[model samples]
Target: MIKFAYTILYVQDVQRSLEFYETVFGFTRKFITPDNSYGELITGDTTLSFAAHDLAKSNLKDGFMKSSNDNKPFAMEIAFSTDNVEALYEQAIKAGAIAEKPAEYKPHGQTVAYVRDLDGFLVEICTPME
Candidate 1:
């Protein structure tokens, strides 16, 4: 049975991303590599593995690979669901995250907002419809 799964994101700077995640999501370090290429981050019941972009490219070479700066574009993102959307949104901004969309109650039924990480990965922070 699957107990849990972690999302691994590739970032340019480990410390910058680490500080952003830790501050915004309240994540605690579970483990960090000596070279800071990969690690586990825990917040509540979730564990996120953050890998440096260059390292991830090499790791994925066994499969079909593309340059991190390919012309076609290489990108990914993660959504952070939270209860106190407004407060977290404010905190995220204070933590140096650039807001892509202001928080609002969308017609689709959620209080949603968007922010781009240091590397331009979209992070949707939201609360489900009540």
Candidate 2:
């Protein structure tokens, strides 16, 4: 069977990115390399990982677009489902995440909000779909 294990975001600073996720999302740290170029967080069944730009460049022959707050967010986003969307949204902003939208109820009865992480990655905070 095929299963999704983790998603790695290429970031300028792996340690900083890992810390941001831990502080804003409350995910515990799994480990970071001694060089601080790569790290992982124990985010439930699927791990959330980060690789430094330099490390990622070495791994991929071709370069990739870098995320930046100055630019519009990418087409994709990482969503977190939570019962307390308002509280978490507030906390994320306070923890340095840029608020994209405030929590609002959708016609489907879900509460959703958006924010950009330090590296400009889109993050969605929302209520679980019923």
Candidate 3:
């Protein structure tokens, strides 16, 4: 017996990541601890958990990793599906995120681009192409 649902990614800075998700992807805050050590963001049924780097490592194999990693040319980016692409893209730019590629409509029916969050995670925000 097994259930399929939910995902949690290790984030570097809780406030920074919270800002990026809330501003860029329009995720609402589920909860934020006063110490800024733990928080959760919700977009519909999706739950994004943000745990402090120091705490995260301790939870690992005797604190294997000390910090969050900046996925460069290796790890896959997290893709978020949205109804509005351009608006979110612009908002992300205003939020101090660096956009590697400007948003563009594709023949494959997607208006998409990539933006780097505070921790260097690539986020792909997209909608159907025009």
RMSD of each: 3.5, 0.8, 3.0
lDDT of 2 by residue, 10-92 (tens): 99899889888998889999999999999999998899999999999998898899999999999999999999999999999
Model 3 C-alpha lDDT per residue in residues 1-130, reported as the tens digit of each score: 6653455556667887888788777789998889888888886555777788777777787663322234452266777877877778778889877777878888787888887766666778888445
Question: Given candidate 3, what's the lDDT at residue 26?
Answer: 73
Cα deviation at 44, candidate 2, in Å, is: 1.2
TM-score of each: 0.78, 0.97, 0.78
Which one is best on TM-score?
A: 2
Worst lDDT run of 10 residues, candidate 2, spans 15-24
Query: Once superposed on the true structure, which residue ranges of model 1 sit more than 4 Å away at CA?
Result: 2-4, 44-46, 62-76
- Report the lDDT tens digits of candidate 1 across residue range 1-130: 7776777777777767787888888888888889988877886565777788778878785643332322323455577888778888888888877777888988888898887766566788899657
TM-score of 1: 0.78
Q: Cα deviation of 76 in candidate 2 (Å)?
A: 0.3
Q: List clash counts for every candidate, in order.
A: 0, 0, 2
Best by lDDT: 2
Candidate 1: clashing pairs of residues: none
